[model samples]
Target chain A: MSITEQRPVISKLEQQELRRLLAENKRIDGRNPLQYRNISVQLGYVEKAEGSALVELGNTKVLAAVKVGIAVPFADTPNEGILIVNAELVPLASPVFEPGPPSEESISLSRYVDRSIRESKSIDLSSLCIVPGRSVYSLYVDLYILDYDGNLIDASVIASVNALGITKMPKYVVEGQAIKKTDEYFKLDLKDHPVSLTYAFLDDKYVVDPCLSEEYASDFTVSMTVKADDRFCAIQKNGGGMISPRRVIELLERSLELGKELRTVAYRQLAGGNG
Target chain B: MLRSNEQQQRQRPIVVPGEYVGDSKFHIPGLNVYRLSDRMLATTVGLVRIDGKRVDVVALKSFYQPKVGDLVVGIVKEPGTAGWTVDINSPFLAFLPLSEYPEKRIRLSRDSIGRILEAGTVLVGLIKDASIFSSPVITLKGKGLGVVSNGFLLSITASKVPRLIGKKGSMLSTIEKGANVKLTVGQNGRLIVHSEDLNVVMKVKEVIGMIEKESHVYGLTERVEALLAGRRP
Candidate 1:
């Protein structure tokens, strides 16, 4: 998540040009109005972290680092493990981001990313449990925003899922009262890949993956995370404008369609070792 | 680009740390590769490049490593009594002492230093002194190397920078001629394209993306020229 300025961040002339381009079905970068920018995922970026991925979607960039720790399981979900998502918008990314605590935008970003993975049941949380209620593996997903152009949520979610997918847990053998870590490591059980789609509603038209300049041209932004099965796992609408029921449903349909296209590329790249 | 005989002898395989490259007897361990008894192991993810007895791994991803004789754009982050702590987009912030300002010999006082460069000032300078133990140093004691008046600043992946600046700067000239923009590319990944027209800036961005996406393919220079000429559909 990035700071959403109170006033218009883009120049009026730039905003006018963006709208004019969209009206003519021409994107500033020559992509179709319904197209998303090219996304490339680089895994194992932060070798120190348990698992990490650097996700680049056009000019926007985000890095997700996963750190696994052993902790007590929650009382209610004693059988399941915990996954905490934290996002930080680095000041080096843009001028608007200040050097300080996490912004409200970043907080929303972490929650949305957490919900997408959680609601989609992408990881087998139960498998992360070591001892029913006594001990469980805690996966901490720290998202560091390297650069913010636009559509941070979509990029963040993709990085988080792929980072978790490539994660491997060291073998743990529990004694009478002590848990010991072994030299062996087992790959994580990644079940599904979920992708998020951001559509900017501007003048009754919804454009996919709005760039930073184009972001300021829209009033309402609808973002939805779709699972591999074409199910909506997470959906959000940033404060701006409203959409009718028909429009929301139509956006959902489009999200599912784009979700398949993005998933194929995302997973294929995930399996590719170069990342 | 033609490869040296030794470069051809050394296989440029993408290797991760701890992966064995070759037998040390056949190939000597070079930069980013360590010797372990009889085998040479890679220490990073990069293409292994060898020139004669010297074998080195060229990493695709690059971090700003300040070295002597490199031209860099420095942003003034701190203007203190000692000197200015400039953000060179590196692991360590570089220091620009007041003495290295120019031959005119500005006063050593803080006020005099402020006159040269204040916080938020961006200057193009050279890495005069660089030591891993100490903060790297920069100097603005050369021509065309001083505070930038105004220009468009942008960055692409540092690894992809080589593609933008082609072999022997062939690609850089291609972009400058095709887009009609004077651009100075910093090895650290940031670039300054001097153009007031937004359309020109936008075109440069397209040119960069095209090169980055198709850098591996052959005959990229002509494709970029044709794209600039509006011959591409």
Candidate 2:
């Protein structure tokens, strides 16, 4: 038997109520329009992985694990280490997720995270290089959606960033064409932190960190990633609805502010020791 | 071993899947508890309940299992020539046949069925038949069973339905009277809340959320009553 994603049916009355609540700047969960749900970050959750983190945003839970290995660099970027991001919407996480190959949604999530991390230059890729072109460290960030209550992109980003921040790789020595491993290990050098903020636009009104029901009711969503230095690293708009340029700018400013707050929380957890 | 009456008075211990609940010799394995040789192990995350000689695990979170005569709030998924496919927040989609509808003899056409109950139309119904081999059949002929036109729907963990209803529907009545709203609770954890004031609806939603989260805790009813009276508990 084949398993398929089942979308929760939203009654017309609920939809109407959701719109009315948005007009009044009130949410069903009693949060303000620009406020995010409670965020909790746990580092080093997966002991076997080089680094791992579990982040819970409200009811949504995402786990990220980083596995580092030595591999030859790509032809175009021989000196820079490679970072591969993969996301899986685990079937057990939600009724809508099915066990199969990565869907378009998961692919888009991975790509969005990849752009945010790579474009922001969070990790010093040059430092991971064992040799100029022969061998370098390759980091694979695998994100598993443990619970999908919506705002998955932001939750995944938080987990990935914290996982990467605590990542430790075994030291390697260059001996001519080959690289030799050493007993010593060093933490991955992270230069910057990037946080993503997503907003679900319910008609003209928008809410930050929308829950599952809100996400389903929303017309479209815009996700903006900001670097620690207040730079816009990546921006993505999903769904069929369109947004005016003015709203986009407004969202960007909000993202910048929210991004700093998110970074503080992530860093505080990272510094407070493993959970 | 069975606990003494003094120990039984204490709160039930929460258990995770595969945890050793008790020995099968002293207590018979019940719901969500599997017998591994002579030992009973919990098969799901839940609270352990030992009643007489039976040990059962009441799951904290689970899908609703349909049973005959149980009231449910269902959303119409698709219309067929004979009936409509309805989602009842269960693993199996329940079926609502045209014959089961309260209406008199009507032509068997997809358009006719669609016009009667289109996709996403929320309604309350009774499970007429439930079996493992096929989808459960629901009937709308019963009183207070029909299309839910105005009220919005809210859902909590299906396992906590009993807690939300409370002893002899005491908790439900308290919330209804306190917030001035009527709730049509489904056995499947869905609730259709009827109220004229949006503020009352919000209060009901908040109270339900609190109950769902703290259903396992002791003295929850008293705290719920305190919260309803506009006092923080």
Candidate 3:
């Protein structure tokens, strides 16, 4: 129970209602067992940020903003650009979340989202390298959770990728070793589109895209990130529950299928229906 | 009728923030429209309603700003000595004082206060006092008010509450008759649909969603009826 505080206690009556609905293949909001909620992505809401997207998945809302700046790269990855993902679980989003430094849940969320984007090669980091050993462009993807209705990982992943898609880095005039900043900006080239799929472990069943109520009622959840080209990037099993080897395999196959369909939704929204 | 009406009104195109509408000298800037230098610009995204010489920007999404005498649906979060903290879907939680309670208040008694309004208890009441400097005050003193224990709550955009209720309760009557449920609508984008059958409550929720989506368009009542009757429009 790493979630010591800020976790809403699930009442017995509410759990019974949700469990009964799930057993009957009926969700609280009338969605199918495998069906995800109504997801819509609004791009470029924050003007000050280089890129921004407000993603609405049913009632769960997440805002992703990217800030581009010049900074020194890490020692080991000096030649490549940097990708930093920070998540804020603001108390205003849900009564359960607290207002302070990032909690354990938020830190884990940011790391998982970061691994999916970095390992999948979503952004071409090498191209962001203005200087091999010195200064490089650092992109910060900050996720602000505006609403908490469960399955936050999937929503945050999509919002971050969409924000990265719309990010524009400032251009610099390079002369020998000196670089001067210019008013012009160039869109960062996004290589791959990765989407995440989350499934909650209920009693002897796996429910995909669990709502807030269903999430609290469930025992554990598994989140899988897959690329558009059918490549799996990262997998995380949250909560203290054991899963059979057969169930793990079964989950991976189902997640891949859903990932493909969701990738198109995210890609199309980023391209304004052109994709 | 809709086509002629739209033409006669000279419909203003939908404008977003930073979009130029007209000159400030000729048209007075309304809500969400700010004057920059000599030009008028929109500060929010919504449909533009140009009335004579005044231009008003009506945002599609409405945030509830509290005012006195408005009926609202609130949920009790914490019980205090004199009043209970009720979340009225606003930036601030309202106070349901002991005077507004249906039961009489016992002087300096905490046990009696819990009996009146406890945590998780839903109430349908009216705002008795609202001050910018203080938390708004609510009262359970109106008809069809007090603890809402049997019904389900559904919310839509505050701007569409008028459309869902229709002009003079005509649209509301259509929904109630079509779904066979007693509906109470709040101006702050909350509603209570009471029906014995769970399906009727669900049907009313879908109808309200249709009203919100098509509120900007004309002839919404017929489409809403078609949705409730399970027919294709």
* Best first by TM-score, ranked: 2, 3, 1
lDDT of 2 by residue, B1-233 (tens): 35457645665789999999999889999999999899999999999988899998989888999999999999998898789999999999999998899988676643477888888899999999999998999999989999988877889889888889888999899898888788999999999889646778778888998988777666678778888899987
Interface RMSD of each: 8.1, 1.6, 4.8
| Recovery fraction of native interface contacts for candidate 3 | 0.00
- Candidate No. with top lDDT: 2
Q: Which 10-residue window in model 1 chain A sums to the lowest lDDT?
A: A7-16
Tens digits of per-residue lDDT, candidate 2, A1-275, equal: 44333457767667777788889888877789988899898889999999999999999999999999999999998898989999999998988887888887898999999999999998888877878788899999999999999999999998999999899998998777667889999988777778899999888899999999899888888999988789999999988789999999999888888877777876676653321
Tell me how much of the true interface, by contacts, candidate 1 captures.
0.00
Docking quality of model 1: it rates as incorrect
RMSD of 3: 7.6
Per-residue CA lDDT of candidate 1, range A1-275, in tens?
56555532233334545666677787666789898898898988999888899999998999999998889999999988899999998989976777778788788999999999999898889989999999999999999999988899999998998898888777788999999888888877878889999998778777999988677668878899998888899999986677899999999999888888888876665663221
Chain B, model 2, TM-score against the native? 0.92
Q: Pairs clashing in candidate 3?
A: none
Can you tell me which runs of candidate 2 are displaced by over 4 Å?
A1-6, A268-275, B1-9, B13-45, B48-56, B103-112, B196-202, B213-218
Alpha carbon lDDT at A269, candidate 1:
59
How many clashes in each structure?
0, 0, 0
Worst 10 residues of 3 chain B by lDDT: B1-10
lDDT by residue (tens digit), candidate 1, B1-233: 55567645543467788887777777887878899899788888777677777677766566778889888877787677867888787778899987777757555653466666766676788998899799999998888787775666666766667778988999899889888889888766667778755578788888877766655445678888988887882
DockQ score of candidate 3?
A: 0.07
TM-score of chain A of 3: 0.95
Rate residue A159 of model 2 by lDDT: 93
